[model samples]
Target: MANYNPYENMLQTLDLAADTLGIPRNDYEVLRHPEREMNVAIPVQMDDGHVEVFTGYRCQHSSVLGASKGGLRFHPDADENEVRALGAWMTIKNAIAHLPYGGGKGGIKVDPKKLSERELERLTRGFVRKIAPIIGVERDVPAPDVNTNPQIMSWIVDEYSALTGQWTPGIVTGKPLAIGGSLGRNEATGRGCMFTLLSYLEKQGTSIKDLTIAVQGFGNVGSVGALLMHREGAKIVAIGDVHGSLYNANGIDVEKAYEYANSHGRSLEGYEEPGMTRIPNPDLLLLDVDVLYLAALENQVNEANMKEVKAKLILEGANGPLTKDADLYFFEKGIPVLPDVLANGGGVVVSYYEWVQNKAGFYWSEEEVNEKLAKNMKKSFEEVWAMQEEFKVYPRLAAYMVALRRLVEALKIKGYNG
Candidate 1:
């Protein structure tokens, strides 16, 4: 973290993927830089009669595929570099999911939890007003990310609609169902992780019921992924949050952990079970389990801690959970990783479906949505797996190869329109 830059990390992976794919540097040099980056000043009036100004950013990595799409988060560390990296990753994620979209991401550097509901709404509206000109239902769409959720998405939809004077739900996804949100949108990312893990196990002639797993991060994506894997009969021996980690050698009751998290502001700080043990946040990844579900943030498992990871497989539940060096280390160690682009793509895949429903005024049932998500995630995994086998490369590079190849071909077919 002392010298970690998310955008630089993204570029490193992009370069590695391109080099492995044997594509000309010119073919992907464009991806090294974002197409556009928008930073804005958001001024909000607090309940105490004071004005606080917040800095926010939105970056569009590419639009060669179609309109740009990604999530927007409110975090204390949100900045241009992080947003740029996230947007670039979104491009590859969309490509791997085979969706007609590019990548974009935005976030304000603030803790939303500290803001009152009214104040948060004002901040949301203010951010939308500044980014409004460049974003639209067909141009760019933003959804919720860390410390953001459906209620916040509803605010985004309302503000964007008010600015355009039209009820355009397509401008955002992951909304409450009443506002044209797709069913299963909330748990789509986690569910997609579950599907990918199951698919991997099925391919390996193994059973999920016998696996011991540890998860880092107990928020939306992490908790949902934990619960789904639990349903599959996997032993979730450890789980963690921003506060710290929880472990039970036999298995932690994911249901109780999840319920407690929901009841306590998504933090696992005070959670306890009969045999549960509290460990340092860093220790969660070192648990000698069958799988390490990295659902936290960037730079968590870089060189400083890569050697300590004992999981045989990793499911990237968060974007950039493993840095380039850690990722390559795992690959060299013969550990299989379901990379973020292919692993956590369920959120974006279902987001695409939500946008489609909004465009058609037709929504899907929860069962229909889950089926579609599983099918898409499984397909992407299989494609990435095939690429891995064909090139003898790690899953992450293989996934990037698949996505980068797709983007490059699209560029070749489109050629210079100028």
Candidate 2:
């Protein structure tokens, strides 16, 4: 993993896709870097009557399609390089999903868990104020990611509106229901993964009920994905979060586990149940399950641990969870690894819906939102599958091909031929 940098990984993938498509180097070279990057220093007054400074970043990878769109993560590990990589991935993800938007991502270098509620609000508002000049409904929209959530989004919307002196819910996605947030927005990513998996299984004459799944990363994406898959009769044998891992071959009660995690401060530590055994988080990755859903951070499956991955199918629910080396290893070993650009695009897809609803001032019901998401996800899966077969490449490269073709066309149309 020493040689792995998220931004560099994105560039290598981009280069491969462009070369495969025979796109002129000049036509797609701009995509090798972000169009704009904004770093801000946010100073917030703490509840203890002290001010703390935080560094934040918002990188707009591309807006060739339309307004840049992505999520804002709050983690101590947040930095410009990671944000740039995530932003670039968003560009690919949105293109593959066929959304008329580009890619952007923002994050602040602070641990939300260490701050009080009031302090978090202040920090969020300060970050928004600092970055508001570059973000807008028609410029770039931000959403929830990692430690950030709907509540933080609400704060951003309020702060941005206050700054502009107008109600601009369109300035952000993933807001509360009372706001302009679309229904089914929270579960969009997880549900999208489920839909993609089910569609792929059906095409192969297999049923989800017959597969045993182990989900690493029990956060919003992982927990919801595990629950939805479990609801569809999949046996979720193991689940893990930052705290620890839980295993039960007979299929742990997903709902109970979800509830426990939610009520226990979102950690699976000390959770007890009959027939359940605790395991290390890394061990969860080596579990002998039919499916492995990687919903954790990037590079979780690197060269060091690729050989130990026993799951027949690896579905990425997190961005860049598998490094290029690990991805190539899986391809060589004939293990089908679903790339994140296609699998975890549900969040951004629903974000597109939310953006639409915000512009139209008309919101759809949860059923409608989910139906649209499923249709889009299925369509994207078919397209990627076709590309994979046509090019005889892994899904990751195939996805990059699909996205690169779209992006290149947009660039050429915009008179960037040179």
Candidate 3:
């Protein structure tokens, strides 16, 4: 409903970050544009014998640090420019997380909910076939985003392997554990979000048990984040998905809601519990809670509804949840936002570990993987927090500073820019 362009949002953030750093425009102009953008048409044969062509886009924003790394989203709103913006964010995210990778993103313009399982599989294979030439273990690796999941990544890995006549589990991440996936892969993002939140709370001298949380999106990230927060003694008073939003004055039993939604194919439409009242999803955003988690689609928090936000802290569990204009609005209100790069960077952090394991032909135990991830995430968080304090800027811009600093170094070393 908002006339926001995500790419323009990204550029504004980049421009502000550059201005804060006082870097000349000529030094980072190359990063303002993607290195490569590929748009392809996948014509698939439906079970009814009709040919349907779906538009797909893959954008490699940068590769100076390492192979291009990002997720593949399947949604009706996906477009070339959106994918381009997401790819650019991927680069910034990896850099801020201090990962040895660049950024890329791809998406297909179709609502997976409208397609049957067979049709989804066919479309996945078709997409893999189309993009196989540009993606691989040492090249651009794709993971799951939006409506896509590990099963979709599995299909891509299988289809790409079939085309190349080899087994390369490293070619794709977020795959099921049966196919060389890493331990703690499923809950990595949510768990990492919890970790970062706790870490920030500790730094702020606030007790997690005393806070209230309102999560917008009961999907993988939000559900797990809410559940984890509940376990930590935080009261979850509001939650919502595409179905609707639900609130309880006391607290909704997150475990029960998760079970109901999981058994019902990830829908919270008819979920019933004591003290539960149905409300609009937008209303959930404005709920009075200490922590507001955005785990839904992009533009969920924008300029139009920015005035309604009531949370003191925002954890971006989803990518690009806050547009630039909305972010500035929140910043002016003294509401600190933990950007997606620093919050949701956990998933890709562990994905990089998975890739290393797959390449070395050895894997780490769950404890080892989690320990390594925690170390990396904590380090990244500390760096961003320090940057925020030093620059007297918002956390999002501080995160971009962390990433841009690293990226400029990489570019200098690569001789792309001096």
Candidate 4:
């Protein structure tokens, strides 16, 4: 993993997909770089009256399909390379989901957990103010990712609206419901992963009830995903968060666990219940379960631990959870590793819906939002599954092929083929 670069990982996948598609280099070479990238210095006034400067980045990978769309992550490890890779992955994700959008991503290098509420608000507003010139409903739209959430998005909308002197809820997504957020946005990513899993299992003539699952992250994506899968009659045997891991061989009560975490300061540090036992976080990955869901950060399943992952089927809830070598290792071992571009696309799909509703000034009911999200996720899974079967490649490579084909066609139509 010494030479592993997220951006290079994306490019390597793109090259493999292009080669498989038999596309000439001239038709797809332009996609190797971002269309535009901006680095800004954001100055915020701390509560103690001292001014601090922060670095932020917004990278638009492509706009050939439409205006760019992605998320803004607030994390200490965020950098130009990671942001660029995420932007490229967003482009592929949108294309895989068949959404009319390109790919873009932005981030500020700061640990949001360490900031006070007021300081966080000031930092979000400052970052928005700096990127406002390039972002809008018709230019680039951003949603919440990682440490960012609906509250941060609401702050951005408020700040952007104040600066422009107009109501533009469509300029950003993942806002609070009171401020034009979509009804089903919170659980969209997890629900999408669930739908994809069901689709794959159905194809294999397996029932959700027959599977046991272990989730490697208990954040919004992991917790919601575990709950939804449990609702579908799957046995959730184990779940873990950054704090620790919990296991119950007789199946954990996902709903109860979710509520417990929510009420206990958004952590599972001390969650207790009958039949549950504490385990090491890494041990959760090696659980004797039928499926393992990776909803944590990138590179969690790298070459070092590839052989330790015992799940027969792996689904990604986070972006780039598996390194390139880890993915290939799974493929060689005949373990199916679903790609994030297809598995976690529910969030972006609903973000598109929110953008549509905001533009139309009409809100959709939760039922409507959920129905449409499920349909889109199923369709995307089928397409990627078919591609994998046709190419005899891993799901990750197949997803890249599907997305690259769509992107290359759009670029050709725009006369960027040369």
- Scored by lDDT, model 4 comes in at 0.93
Q: Give the per-residue lDDT of model 2 (tens digit) for 9-100.
A: 88988899888878878989889879999999999998989889999999999999999999999999999999999999999999999999
Write down the TM-score for model 1.
0.97
- Clashing pairs in model 2? none
Count clashing residue pairs per candidate: 0, 0, 0, 0
lDDT of each: 0.91, 0.93, 0.89, 0.93
lDDT of 3: 0.89
Local error of candidate 2 at residue 218 (angstroms): 0.7
Total colliding residue pairs, candidate 3: 0
Q: Taking the tens digit of each residue's C-alpha lDDT, what string does model 3 give over 139-230?
A: 89999888888899899988998999999899988888888899987778888898889889989899989988898988888888888888
Which regions of candidate 4 deviate over 4 angstroms? none
lDDT (Cα, 0-100) at 331 in candidate 4: 97
Checking candidate 3 for backbone clashes, the offending pairs are none
For model 2, the superposed segments whose C-alpha errors exceed 4 Å read none
The CA lDDT at 233 in model 4 is: 99
RMSD of 3: 1.2
Q: How do the residues 30-97 of candidate 1 rate in per-residue lDDT, one tens digit apiece?
A: 87889999999999999999999999999999998999999999999998889998999999999999
